[model samples]
Target: MTPHVPALPAMGVVALLRALLKRPRRPLPSALPEIVTEYRLDRLPLDDIARYRAAFGFPGEHIPLTWWYLPAQRAHLAT
Candidate 1:
């Protein structure tokens, strides 16, 4: 496999995204696929944490809310 290339093709990725997209009023499937993608930050540096906190008004242990999207988007593609 080429180091720079992903295993899934662009069309496949687009189809997956399309399939996962839904309107707010639509009901999600009760049965879900047994796929999970976990994304971890080994460490959030003190400087970065402080910068994020200062920029976003996150005072303490709470991370930026948007951070959750990384793993969620990963989970979407994995399935």
Candidate 2:
């Protein structure tokens, strides 16, 4: 014989339906005032640049393709 599965209680089923039908709350706007911050990749410190290059295994003096994300992330966080 197959084992019988228990069903959810009426209250539990109602709560689940209410939860499923509930609308998502809208996100609140930022309270902090906007500020502009300038970022210059060329101005990065020599040591930091050296470390970045070394981490990515770039022997030559050039920024890697993956390094572009740094500036993009900085800009996004600034907003």
Best by lDDT: 2
Task: Put down candidate 1 lDDT per residue, 29-65, tens digits, no spaces.
Answer: 9999895656666765667656867877776777677
Top TM-score model = 2
Candidate 2 residue-wise lDDT, 1-79, digit = tens:
9999998766778788999899869867769667777766567566766788998798888767677687788888976
After superposition, the stretches of candidate 1 with alpha carbons farther than 4 Å from their true spots are 1-32, 57-79
What are the candidates' C-alpha RMSDs? 13.7, 8.5
TM-score of each: 0.28, 0.42
Candidate 2: segments with Cα more than 4 A from true spot: 1-42
Q: Candidate 2: lDDT over CA atoms?
A: 0.77
